[model samples]
Target: MMDKMILKRLMNDHKNIAILLDVLAKKNHKLSEGEAVNFALIRDVVEYMQVYAEHSHHPLEDITYDYFVKKFSSPCNQQLHEEHSSLAESSGALMYSLNLILSDVVISREKLISDLKAYVEMQKAHMQYEESELFPLFAKQLETDDWDKIKLQCEQRLVDDPLFSDTGDNIFEDLKEHIEAG
Candidate 1:
């Protein structure tokens, strides 16, 4: 039951995160076209990803993937682990870039747009790889004991989704409103 819940939550997070990525893509498009883009929305999306996706979602996946590695001994597990850490690093760097731009530091617009596009593509690819390849393996092979251990570890450090959660201190109010308006 807990395993199903965890998997379901991860999948749901992918869906929500995907929407934000699309927003990023759109903003990148606007910038590439020399049009005004909402940097705040980009920052909000990146911040949410840093907090929820990096600190929360990726760690939960690490827990699951760690257990999976122990059980299955697959060759691709190392790559999976690295991808999580790499993405977290990317989010941090992106957040720093956003902050600099927000503070009126002269960041190159083309560089920022390139970074956003690359980050979005990496995220989409990672999620797709997990959903298509790893998730099915997890669904079929992860036993009750594995699930129990993963659940316990996950429960120790769960972070709530700020934008989508009813109980979170929603700091990204404008981003949320924009999402809702569409």
Candidate 2:
């Protein structure tokens, strides 16, 4: 079984990502309505998705997936594994497209918004699959020793997440304010 602390941390990451997606969706709606969007806030939100969600969160899940696959020999989780890889690329592309738009370059706003929605949907689906399918599988199959090893591996793979970290980089201030206000 996955350790309680590890499971809680991963679940919290999913929650945080969900909050950011809602923030991004709200920004997209404002843009669609021809209202002024806070580009800086959008940028910060994208950066968090790229840095913390894609970079840190996905890889940790990948570790869990890897361990699960090693022990269980089930192919059912393959799609979720593939989604993890694709999400990183999708998030990177979204960030790049957002940067171009912010630089006064004319990219199709519709396409960018479409991509953002797609990414958010895919991420949410991925998390749901993990919570429903993968986590339960891990809990049933993995033993205490297995979790100990996975925990050590996850700790070694951990990155200091700026959005969740104590260091107050003010870029996330707007995003935090938006989350609280909503």
The candidate maximizing TM-score is 1
How badly does each model clash, as a count of residue pairs? 0, 1
Each model's lDDT comes to: 0.86, 0.78
Candidate 2 C-alpha lDDT tens digits along 42-156: 8888788877776777778888778777777766546866887888788788888878878999888788778978887888888889899878777777778888788888886
User: What digit string (tens of lDDT, one per residue) describes model 1 on residues 66-140?
Assistant: 878877787554777888888888888899999998898989888898898889999999999999988888888
Clashes of 1: 0
Q: Show the colliding residue pairs in model 2.
A: 1-142
Model 2, position 173: C-alpha lDDT score:
78
Per-model root-mean-square deviation over C-alphas: 1.5, 2.3
